[model samples]
Target chain A: MTSTSTAAVHALAALPQPYLLFLGDTTEAGFAKTAIGLHDWAPEVCVAEWSLPGCPISTGLPTMTPAQARAAGARAMVIGVANGGGVISATWLPALVEALEQGLDLVSGMHQQLGDIPELAAAAERSGRQLINVRVPPRGIPVGNGRKRSGKRVLTVGTDCALGKKYTALALARGLRGIGVDADFRASGQTGILIAGSGIPMDAVVADFSAGAAELLSPDAAEDHWDVIEGQGSLFHPAYAGVSLGLLHGSQPDVFVVCHQPGRQHVLGYPDYPLPSIEDVIDLTVRLGRRTNPAIRCVGVSLNTHGMTEQDAQAACAEISARLGLPTADPMRQDGRFNRLLEACIA
Target chain B: MTSTSTAAVHALAALPQPYLLFLGDTTEAGFAKTAIGLHDWAPEVCVAEWSLPGCPISTGLPTMTPAQARAAGARAMVIGVANGGGVISATWLPALVEALEQGLDLVSGMHQQLGDIPELAAAAERSGRQLINVRVPPRGIPVGNGRKRSGKRVLTVGTDCALGKKYTALALARGLRGIGVDADFRASGQTGILIAGSGIPMDAVVADFSAGAAELLSPDAAEDHWDVIEGQGSLFHPAYAGVSLGLLHGSQPDVFVVCHQPGRQHVLGYPDYPLPSIEDVIDLTVRLGRRTNPAIRCVGVSLNTHGMTEQDAQAACAEISARLGLPTADPMRQDGRFNRLLEACIA
Candidate 1:
């Protein structure tokens, strides 16, 4: 097996058995996508499925009950539900509680949990179910492979449906490769607060990849599977962006950068649109860091211009760095100073 | 007027007209309270009610047609719904669109956009009604106040809610007061993104506040009302923090500080909690600002601890600042260096 594969296997092998479960419902496509991603990272992990009972005509799929899920010997469970309000009802809570009471793990394929289901959060806390939240992009976005080998160490990038998080992840990974760091992008399910890559089953390969990140960035910790990078374009999506800071906290990244586009969705009523200048971002970062965790040593800033010209993108980056009083370098063309700074801190 | 009344008037007079709205179901307490606040703020601003014909409730209230609201010169409108979910029926959208189409202003008591009513965000955008998003905190908290004033300057503090925004806001406000800054706490509604001021009509206040903020802070152009300092919270809540930011972007401020806290709600299914550090918040702030406007200059950092002693708080603050590379100072005590910094930036 490749080193990445071996590492993922090792991480999965080290994990306690029966600690994870996978829950499936009508929106199996979305669920399967995320499950597949999780499975890819940790192949040896066993997942239990409990389909929702009384399949509504809308979805027309059988669902498993809490008892069935329990019978599957799942200590942890991942649930994927169909979209639409009717499907998320009080009945689901009981099943969820059952799993949690039995000390089973819990993860969700719910897109953006904050306003979507307040009860779910309350229930999880009450039942002590370890819930991992996943937000599938608006649909039809490919997953990104974070493989980098070059210039500035593009350490982190996030993706969600249309937010171009995957693209950014890919770009960052590729950019890092161009700069000489072996970087790879991995999706941590939902990329916001309340839920992130925390609960889904990570295969051995994925677990090892997570371990590598933990070791390289935060070696003192046993393993860091919760550090979810901020997804792109989320800064502007209503109810999704501001609270993302909460998710970032859940993920525990050394440095977090929010990628944004200005004037693209200006009329959408998204709060973070007309993206703040780089300086503003840096200033806010420092302030937020001071309040959250002071131990964070370094923060790096990058820009995604949403298909803007290279000059425009560069100008934006330069202007942002100048405003924030931080070092700035081009990701495409290697900047040794910037890379060295990032490598020294993150590595 | 009583001191409370007088304060209310001063606050109201400080706001602009033709930019306010009321929201909530007619029977809901929020509707009545908001109406009372509006009456206190701008007695002359006409209140037009729109109700579905089939809805038999609240028959005595003054109801208006879409055209009547337009003709009555209603620049803002408020809707009272039963709960956060009531805003999403087909009946509500037409009237809302009518108001927006006819250029009526908007506000709501529910703490989240009526458009968030089910699939309304997508529908509204598709229908050409530019929906400004806002988020209110969840059910457990009260409103928030503005910064504390010490002589002529102000001090502000922030925190991630799970790590402690409420406590931080309260503590920082108290800290500012201790230092002789007449400080007060402000709630960023439910989502902790926007400041939830009591007894203030948002629409009426938005224009004046935005203008004032612009004149005081940027002055070059109109600021994003959703991005103002006090308007920093979640966008999903009905009272979006972005609206506050937008309104206050260029308005008054001698200093700005964002509080950061550790610990977060665990993601479902993750084996461990990904608690974000102060550094993560700092990085987030920087990125958030960059994604919007980068003009905000952070001058202070407050470390929020859950009921820690003064000594512990100070130690936490010191450690956090040293690690984040930001200067640290106690807002409770006056210092020439800090004073100099504030004076130079605000001036």
Candidate 2:
């Protein structure tokens, strides 16, 4: 009774590929942060999306059945929504169970551990499936002492929580590597942890030990290698500023990139709290960073212009660049403007 | 085979109190911050000290034995030193074992979990003695949202790390109660946790949740009760400033008392990092706190004039008070000058 169209099955045959069926159905499909991240990063590994039965509209990816997903060599069914409080919806349980029955692995970056759910865990266990929960921090992370080390440490800080700090850091790291630079990406959050293979989920760490996690991640790189540390939270976020400051102090970055989503008028969680101006965030970052490292500087801006026209993105980037007297770019846009940021970071 | 001094036993009997064998032999005696804290707060609970075998020149308390300590009604063996990185020394194992065997409870505010030690834990288990690890955080602490709460929260911040913020807050609380005001002391560190019997070891908490622990500890206090929130590390401590900021943000106090130890030459752990001026610390606290609550204010000064001449203490307090236009007092000196500070806080 499940829909596995022949056209969808044939589409799987053209490439020797194993992809992910990002389950962003109903509420998750319309506005999911994790799904949006996967949309950008998953194409390299995934070929299709899988929505709930009643919700067919995905974020423009071709929808697929578990059989077609298997035909296309699907490896895992990713719970791709940035679910509020990270609790998995009861609505999605049927699809998740079905996917496990189809011998697919389960992966989630939710705050609520998928491994902790008895049904999904038992299903994964019985079917010999791997349920990789990415939000759990690895143990024995040493407390950060904020000791300054050699080589430039570049961190991407944001104006608000979930404003694409990880995306900016990764993209900047990739862009740097493309230009024959030895820049290593240091992941500091869940999604970044999943993509990068190694990172500390900053939010998951205890407060006093939070900085230590940052210190461990950016251990002494080679003199030529720049460790691009992914930032967490924001200095202005009422709920998360402590973690934000902890990461800022822990990394002891010499240069920082202020990442901002162009259209965010209010803080994501607290509507009453207004987002600080880009200038305010940049000034705050420099002032706080300089408290430990006097030489620290804000070198560029990583503007997340998602869902914007190319002309709008260009104008926003240019306007910010002009106002701040710093290079600004949407790293994912690949409009060649990101080169300016790369040059600024190195310079 | 162990030595128990008769004279020490007589001294303890006269006091009719609990004595602590401050294990400050070896490295702990020279510069143990916790021992220093206990020295200031110990007269409230303890009357004697017990040093290691070779550590004869103790911190001025009459040395006693397990038999002598028991005769004197010693209830617990307090680990007096702030051991480097909060590690319990191997040298103290025999002493701890001896104390445990003598039907005494083991008390430590160390970062190292005493419950994790197989030998010590097993010894405690066999003896049915309690091992009070003061630094263990209560589970399931939520992230602090920095939501404004009712009640007058007065936090005692410091110009540098370990400058007697706890002593100041406790003294202020006492002074407040002495005047018939309803005041509660909220301890935020290990030593304070021991003294107050309730608090979060703020430094041990994971970075993101650090603020949450602070939030939980100083919840909506009674309208008539002034929650005297004890502050932690200094804003200038290079290694611990993130925690300092976290505690600051988490408390979101309406008013703060700035604590300073006269003539502290350098930042505690870092000789290269000079301590910021009292004005600088006050300004920093206001700036940081104002980011969350615009009405936050620096109300007074808690100057620690320990080891100072009475005349010098008065002069120092007067000079700081005059220059800053704020009431400043050496809370421990009990010079009754704290009345001015009390007036400022309540005002």
RMSD of each: 18.7, 8.9
lDDT of 2 by residue, B114-152 (tens): 767777887887887767676666666777776777777
Give the TM-score of chain A in candidate 2: 0.79
Give the range of the ten consecutive residues with the poorest summed lDDT in model 2 chain A: A1-10
Badly placed stretches (over 4 Å) of model 2 are A1-39, A42-140, A222-224, A310-315, B1-107, B118-131
Error of 2 at A30 (Å): 7.2
Q: Score the docking of each candidate (DockQ).
A: 0.02, 0.36
Task: Give the best candidate by DockQ.
Answer: 2
Rate residue A213 of model 2 by lDDT.
Answer: 68
Q: RMSD, model 1, all Cα superposed?
A: 18.7
lDDT of 1 at A63: 35
> How many angstroms is the interface RMSD of candidate 1?
17.8
**lDDT, candidate 1, A195-282, per-residue tens:** 1233221111111122222222211222322222323223222223322322222233455544444334331343333434444444
Q: What tens-digit string does per-residue lDDT give for candidate 2 at A205-237?
A: 766666676777778767788989899888877
Q: Write the per-residue lDDT of candidate 1 for residues B1-347, one digit (tens) a residue.
A: 11112223213122213333333235444534444433432345534546655543442336676467657665555543445453444556666666666655344445345545544444444544434333321211111112221222222324322333333344445444455544444333322211223223222222113223222322222221111223332211112223323223222344455555433343222223243444544444443433334444465564445566667756766686677556554433334433433333234
